[model samples]
Target chain A: MASAPAGTLYRGGEGMWSWVAHRITGVAVFFFLLVHVMDTALVRVSPAAYDAVIATYKTPIVNLMEVGLVGAVLYHALNGIRIVLVDFWEPGPRHQKAMLRGILVVWLLLMIPGAYFMMIHTIEYLFGSTS
Target chain B: MSLEIADPRSPGAVPSGRARNRGNFEKYSWIFMRVSGLVLVFLVLGHLLIMNVLDGGVQRINFGFVAGRWSSPFWQTWDLLQLWLAMLHGANGMRTVINDYAEKPSTNFRLRMLLYVVTVFIIALGTLVIFTFDPNLA
Candidate 1:
C-alpha cells in the first residue's frame, strides 16, 4: 500500500496545499522553538556561555536562515488564525478559500517590511567589508 | 447511472470523528486552539518585535539582555506562559495531523506514541528551564 503506481490519496486544490504548507511550517516552527528555548535558557548557565552561543547567530549563513525562519513563523501564525475562524465562525467554512487569499495578502504585507527590517543588517554585514 | 454510497465513515477516513473516549478532549482542544491562537497572535508578534525588530535587534541579544529581562518576575511569568501555551498549541495541532494521516492502525499507534513522548518531553524540559533559571549562575 505504501507504493502505488496509480493513486493512493487525492491531493489537490489550494486548500490541500494550504494544509500541507501549514503542517510543514508548523513542524519547522516547533523545531526552531525547541532550539530557541534551549539557547535562551543558556543565560542561566553562564553569561559567557550564552554570549558565545548567541554571537554565532551573527554569522552570514545564520543571518540568512533568519529570513526563512521569519517567513515560516508569519505564515504559520496567519494560517493558524484562519483555522480558528474556520472552526468557529458561522460563515467560515464557506469563506475559507477567501480567508486563505486574504491571509496570503496580509502575510505579504507584513513580511515585506519584516524581511526588509530583518535582512538590512545581514546585507550590510555580507557586502560592507568586501572592499 | 446509479451511484454507490461508499462508507465515508470508514475508520481511515479524514477526521472520522472529533470525539473519542476522552471527556470532551476534542471540544476543549478546539476551544483551546482558538483562544490560545488569539492570545498567541499578540504574544508571538510582540516577541518577534522586541527580539528581532527592536533597537539592536538579534544583534544585541546576549546573556546580559536576557538576564536583565528575566530578572523581572513579570517577564519571567510572561515567558513561562508563552512557553506552555505555544507548546501545547503546536503539539495539539500535530496530534490532529497525525490522526488524519496515519491510516494504518499500527502506524497510527506508533506515530502517536512518538508524538506524545516528544511533546511531553519538550514541555517538561522547557518548564524546568523556565522555573529553575538562575541568572546568578557562575
Candidate 2:
C-alpha cells in the first residue's frame, strides 16, 4: 500500500480512531495523575498549606477540567476493555468495529450520568454565589 | 511462533518470534495491558467517586480530609498501587503507539527516550512522596 504524502489526512476508520483516542486519553490521564500526586502530597506538609492548594480545585475552571478528566478516564476504561478483548478473545479481531461501537455506547451510558452529576454541582458553585 | 524476527514495521502484524523468549516481552506487555487495565477500572473509578462525587465533591476535600484517609496503610497502598499501575500502563501503551505511528526510526527512538525519562521521573518522585510522607510535617 502506498503511504500518503506529507500534509494529508490519514482518514483512518474506527480502528485507527480507537488507537488514536486511546493514546490521547492515556496521555491526558497520565498528566493528570502527575499533578494529582503532587497535590495530594501536600498533605504531608501542613494542614493550612494543603488546604490552600486543594481549595483551588473548587474554582469553575478547575471544576470544568475535572469533568474532562472524568470523561477521558471513562472512555479509556471502556475502550481499554475492548482492547483486552481483542487481545485475548478469539473473536475479537473479527468484530473489532462492532466492539468499538459497543465501547462508545457504554461510554455514553456511563459518562452521561457522571457528567450530569459533576456539572450539576459545578454549575451551582459557579453561579450559586451570584444568585 | 516462528524462529525469525518479524519486521516490526508492519502494522496490524504481531511480531513472530523463533526463540522461547524472543517475543515474550511483547506478549507480556499485552498481558500487562489487560491485567492492569482491569485493576485500574476499580481503583480509578473508586478514586473518582471519592474525590469528585462523594461528600460534597471536590469542595469537601482538603488537608484534613486527605490526612484522615492516608492515616491508614490501606489508603496508602491504594494510592501507591494506583500510581505504579497507571504510570506503567500508560508508558507501555505509549511505547506501542510510538512504534506504530512514528515512521522514522530516529523519531521513534527519541520519542520513546523522552517518554521513558518522564515516566521514570514521575514514578520515582511519586513513590518517594508516598513512602516518606509525614503527616506531622505541618
lDDT (0 to 1) per candidate = 0.80, 0.82
Encode model 2's per-residue lDDT on A1-131: one tens digit a residue: 24545333224667778888988999888778878877776666677878888878887788888989998998899888888788789998777789989989988887777776766767775667755
lDDT score of model 1? 0.80
All candidates: TM-score: 0.82, 0.80
In candidate 2, the residue pairs with backbone N, CA or C atoms under 3 Å apart (3 or more residues apart, or in different chains) clash, namely B3-B18
Query: Candidate 2 regions off by >4 Å?
Result: A1-11, A129-131, B1-23, B101-107
* Model-by-model DockQ, in order: 0.47, 0.50
Q: Candidate 2 on B72-133: residue-level lDDT in tens? A: 89988998899999999988987887888998978988999999998898888878877887
Q: Which stretches of candidate 1 lie over 4 Å from their true place?
A: A1-11, A129-131, B1-20
Report per-prediction Cα RMSD to one decimal.
6.8, 5.9
Say which docking band candidate 1 falls in. Answer: acceptable
Docking model 2 quality class: medium
Residues A1-131 of candidate 1: C-alpha lDDT, one tens digit per residue: 23434331224555677888988988788778878877876766788988998987876688768778878888888988888888778898778788999999999998888877776778887777755
DockQ top scorer: 2
